[model samples]
Target: MGKKNVSGWSTIIMLLTAAALFTGCSASAGSKPSAELHEKTMHWDKMPEMTIDLDKSYTAKFTTSMGDFTVKLYAEDSPITVNNFVFLAKQGFYDGLTFHRIMETFMIQGGDPKGNGTGTPGYSIPDELDTELKYEPGIVAMANTGKPNSGGSQFFISTGKDSENLNQMPNYTIFGKVTEGMDTVLAIAKTPVKETKPIEPVIIEKVVIVQS
Candidate 1:
């Protein structure tokens, strides 16, 4: 839960510094992967317990109603997440998705099928916690509940200032942060919420990869 409007002055100095620190939490989508289509295409039981392949960087744009937000990933810093996100993104898994939950000052969490905040990509990644990064505002990280390695498809985008005590927790790998469209993020966060769910769903219509 958060209070008041969370405002962050986008200092050019801070932006440069932030670019040096963030890692890959991951993202997905290109084609419309229908629920029925995915069920037939992917086999949960046969899928490798750990199917993420690192050694790559992924850039994708989030096409939302508010605007488009782009994210860049770092596999070197968060290998497990990088692999996972790339795999899912290539599979077009995040299409037609909703940003299920959006809190005010606190981070907005998504990627759950339950919409109660307890869904995953059918597996979890080990924590790739590094001492360099903290839960700074605009910093993106995975959202986990129990244990250190229980993270999967869920993630959160920070709202206000840096988190005061999140760095103390072990695991919970941070994979990426917002590169542009912080205003859109703030607008999304400011959307009304009830019981942790947004009053008007912020749908990610599609994701497009932007090559360098």
Candidate 2:
């Protein structure tokens, strides 16, 4: 995948960079917030379905017919977002999850409890589209409608080089990059989709955060 779509770590890095500047520093938990993360994670928002993990190198295990894959997260960059994900991963919020939306040459979207692609974790965060990160393949990014800062859990990965039109608006936080099983992601991306959307939903067996 040459990365024709922009959604992944590229977006989050940019957001975090800008957030740092705006907040007078990076988004750090003040004096260690609640570790009472979620024991189970529901769809996006709605409290992450688990407790928050402020700092840590987390891994998410994704099991699919294509195979099982893992991804690590950077809490330092986006604490609340990362914690929510981590909480959900631990709770297996994504266990029965499906890649609801798969647009060929664009991106694959998932993480909505509604499963139809529209759902939130209850609250939305401010926009964090920092320029430090650029749209690149294998990068993980959040999904949102025309609304800015409306990204919840609904996220996508760039199978190929996404257009810079994403830069048109400073939104959608990209947080992590798939370090392994990239071929698996590519294989999923190669699947046939109706009207450029996946005809068969790519379900996520579970999301387990990996430690490296």
**Top model number, lDDT:** 1
RMSD of each: 9.9, 10.9
Worst 10 residues of 2 by lDDT: 20-29
Q: How does residue 76 of candidate 1 score in lDDT?
A: 66
* Stretches > 4 Å off in candidate 2: 1-55, 163-165
* lDDT of model 2 at position 133: 66
| Quality of model 2 by C-alpha lDDT | 0.58
lDDT of every predicted structure (CA atoms): 0.60, 0.58
Task: Supply every candidate's count of residue pairs whose N, Cα or C atoms clash at under 3 angstroms.
Answer: 4, 35
In model 1, pairs of residues that clash are 23-175, 23-176, 24-175, 25-175
Q: Write the per-residue lDDT of candidate 1 for residues 101-181, one digit (tens) a residue.
A: 776666666655444454456566677886376676677777765456766666777787534235433345788878888
